[model samples]
Target: MPLPTGSSQPVYYVGWDVGGWNCDANPASRDALVVLDDALNLVGTPWRGNLRTTLNEARDSRDLIDRLLGLCRHQAQGAEHVVMAIDTPLALPRALLALARGDAVSALGRSQENPYLYRETERWLFQRGITPLSPIKDMIGSQATKGMHLLARFAPHIAACGQWLSDDRTLTVVEGYPSPAKRSPAFAALRQRVNMPATLETMLHQPTPKQQDIQDAWLCALLAWSLRHAAQSVAWPPDSMPAEEGWIFVPVDSLTPPV
Candidate 1:
């Protein structure tokens, strides 16, 4: 029997949340890739693979670039536009990078400088009506610092992609995270304050199968689609003013505050 061909979609976006190690250390360190359709539905099961060891060891940025391009080729097979949101830092805005290099009380207060930089960046985004996709953490939680580090690296990557897609406005890469923390009320409140959408389960209670990183990648893809379609503001240089802005895709339904 012949199988029916699926209908074509206007665009496809893929997001990858690169991790130091796999879900279980026994599995080995592998990058997690998630593919999403234009409708923001999970189009395919996530795939896991080794990080480009050659690039990591050789310090060859090209290897990473090549690997990402190849992933695009595979996931974007027939799509007109493809956006890839990576979970690593791509390029930092000149201003923020400068701040990181500077010595300020707030910046120097942290154990690591990266968190300070991210904290500043988040403030910058929020002021501009742009909500950053970052994990929320409690004041005393150990994970807060880790979440800040993730943003410090990932934000720049998303910005770089924004620069690349400035021309066509078709391809957008963003940073994101899942909402409604299972164990962190402080975190959940923060996401809500930012107007980030949470599922009913997330709003009412935390759900299991908690792969927050994977969910973040999926969110990034959704944001990319929104940017391409003018659902979200697209800011580049020259034509649009260059500001330290982080992109997030809030579901239309989620944009409104909860009653």
Candidate 2:
């Protein structure tokens, strides 16, 4: 489970579980974030809050970046590459966009191939028995838009179907879906193999929404790590998928539902 890096500099994996823009109104909701080093060690205590407050307090874009980085708490200060995996839809379905622009869309009969709601990546998940929430169909538009806002300010350069790299190439942002992974036997085995930290283990047993957010954040961080080092463990989007409709990186073993 130890990830060896080719670069001498350390790589940090971040997981963000996006919530509504204003978490103050919702007691159970929180935008949780967790950080892990290449070695799978927790970098800092998990942070549970909204970015709206941080944005309102920031002086400028640079200051906002610093504020966002500060959430990493003990993240190493020196040369580092950060890959942030977010649990939310990063882009809208292409067909949904076309429909929005007053176009006729077909293929509405089947649940999996519905072009207006599910993206290619989402359909891929459906074929594998993992049901994904549509940003348009589901009521998670707030969460999805919040994730997009984060991508806008941090990593706006799309490198592929599901990835966005920063201007200086120091940061990479990718979409992550942790619900399936959280239920996978493979992930349970992985937790045992990696010797998941005590704090994270404790978070898993708690039934509260706040704790769930933290657990998902940790899983997303692990997804980022797998994308970097254990690529085989990740289900990457196929080339045929459109770049406009981003991909969701899920654990390979999570493709099949647990019986």
Candidate 3:
């Protein structure tokens, strides 16, 4: 289970298992993060805590950026790209975004578009027999609220960065989903045998992966690694995937469900 580093540029992947708006996330609460270097090895150290604790508050967004930049600094001269794969909806559906932005009544009309309530990428995953909760519905649960706030605060920074593994860029963020794959029967079998970090693997075997946020963060990093080095992924609606809505990277084959 060695990680790859064939690419010339140094890219670090970070995984964030987001918490809620009530300030109720921590290592014990299934919200955590992990960092992996270009060679897929741990960088500095993986951490777990409440997003509210790190992020502080909406106006305190700089705290989050400062922390991330510090992580990027772990590499030399900030030449590395930090591809953050966050296990939360990095962006909301267009209608919702509109509603959030004060187009309250206008968004109701477009509701007919994604009448099924799922985002485009979400629908695409469903077509492939993968199921993910609707960001709309999940938003009500507070996790989406926490993530959306960060996206707004960090959008400018992310926008200014490069696409993919750009050397000039210090950060590139993407959406990530680990639940569908983890819930699959195939992954269940591998829980007994797969060779990942011992602590993470053991967490996967728990009755409820409720406290496996750290492990999920590690998987997020692995997904980013596979996408960068191997390019083994499944992106739906190839012709047009909206940047505003965000895309989830699910690595093909073994990464999808442990073998």
Which sections of candidate 3 miss by over 4 Å? Answer: 1-9, 25-30, 56-66, 69-79, 97-116, 139-141, 157-168, 183-210, 234-237, 254-259
Model 1, C-alpha of 234: deviation from truth (Å): 10
lDDT of 2 by residue, 35-106 (tens): 877777777678888877785675543444455568767634545677889999999888888888899675
TM-score attained by model 2? 0.88
Candidate 2: list runs displaced more than 4 Å.
1-5, 55-66, 75-78, 193-200, 205-207, 257-259
Against the true structure, what is each candidate's TM-score?
0.46, 0.88, 0.68
Regions of candidate 1 where Cα sits further than 4 Å from its true position: 1-10, 21-30, 39-41, 53-80, 87-96, 99-116, 119-121, 125-163, 166-171, 180-210, 229-259
Candidate 1 clash pair list: 89-153, 90-157
Candidate 3 structure lDDT: 0.56
Query: Best-fitting candidate, measured by TM-score?
Result: 2
Candidate 1 lDDT over residue span 120-166, tens digit each: 34443444444443332222122233223433432223334233332
Clashing pairs in 2: none
Greater TM-score among 1 and 2 belongs to: 2
Which candidate wins on lDDT?
2
Model 3 Cα RMSD, 1 decimal: 6.5
lDDT of 3 by residue, 198-234 (tens): 6655564562455577668766766565556546342
